[model samples]
Target: MTTHVQLHDRLDYQSVAPLMAELTAIADDMLVIDAGNVRHLGTLPLQVLLSAVRTRAAQGKITRLAHASDNCIDMLGLFGFTPETLTQPEAWT
Candidate 1:
């Protein structure tokens, strides 16, 4: 089953650790992260997301992003992540 994770509006450095912990708990399942309400994006949270992706991949699972706001998309792009890369099932490996 796929679990939908609703991300917070502001994903700054302070929020990364908690988010990472939460995501890590569910890393064994397929995750679809909803970013529609994200108004801010920070590098720390981006790293958390990347780590979640890798964790899921290690378990032969997948993590995908959905409803990403322009800010989220732009920030991810700045970090060299495209929409396709974020959602591609094969990208994790």
Candidate 2:
């Protein structure tokens, strides 16, 4: 099963370490990112996660993103991610 990492607001150098630790421990074939709660992210965190995305892709792994808010998507766009990265967004009823 794929593991979904739910990152809270303030995704910086500190938060990424724990996330990395979690990623390292998981042996799932897929990775899903839930962006519903993210508020702020620093360059380091962005770099770290982006590198992971690239690396995982190189290894033929799956990394899917979902539930990204508009502000979060905008920030990701500033860092080179387009709207296409969001694959399966959930609509709140």
Candidate 3:
């Protein structure tokens, strides 16, 4: 099954716990994170997302980001990440 998670507008330190909890609850083979609303992408939240993607990949599952806002994309780029590369396990290593 595919699971969809909607990202918050401000993904800062304040959003880390909830974001982690939400992503952790998914048990599907495919996880799609909607980033259209995200205006800020903090390091902590990004780390959480990265960990989730890597863990899912290790289990032979897939995790992807969709409809990312320009702000979100730019913030990710600051960390040298593109939406596609963020989901790719190999990119992390």
Candidate 4:
């Protein structure tokens, strides 16, 4: 089954632990991350997302991002990532 995870508006350092825990809980399932509300994508949260993507890929599950906001897209771009690129596990490596 595909599980949808909705990202917070402020994905800063404070959100890392909670986000990681949420993602980890769904590690065995196909994931679709909803990024439409994301206003700030901090490095730590980005790392958490990357880790989740890699883990899902290794387990032969899919991880995708959906409905990304413009700010979220820009923030990802600053780190050389797009919502599409984020889903590719190889990109993280």
- Which is better, 1 or 2, measured by TM-score? 1
1-93: candidate 1 lDDT, tens digit per residue: 888989999999999889988898883468899999988889888888887787687788877889999988898888778756975536545
> Against the hidden true structure, what lDDT does model 4 obtain?
0.92
Which pairs, if any, clash in model 4? none
Q: Model 4, stretches more than 4 Å misplaced?
A: none
Please name the candidate that would achieve the greatest TM-score relative to the true structure. 3
Candidate-wise lDDT, in order: 0.82, 0.70, 0.93, 0.92
Best-to-worst order by TM-score is 3, 4, 1, 2
What lDDT tens digits, residue by residue, belong to model 2 across residues 1-93? 889888777787888788777666656779888887877867877766766776677677777777877777878878666435533222101
Candidate 2: give the clashing pairs.
Answer: none
Task: Identify the runs in model 3 with alpha carbons over 4 angstroms from their true place.
Answer: none
| Model 2 C-alpha lDDT versus the unseen true structure | 0.70
Could you tell me the lDDT of residue 46 within candidate 2? 73
Error of 3 at 88 (Å): 0.3
Worst 10 residues of 3 by lDDT: 84-93
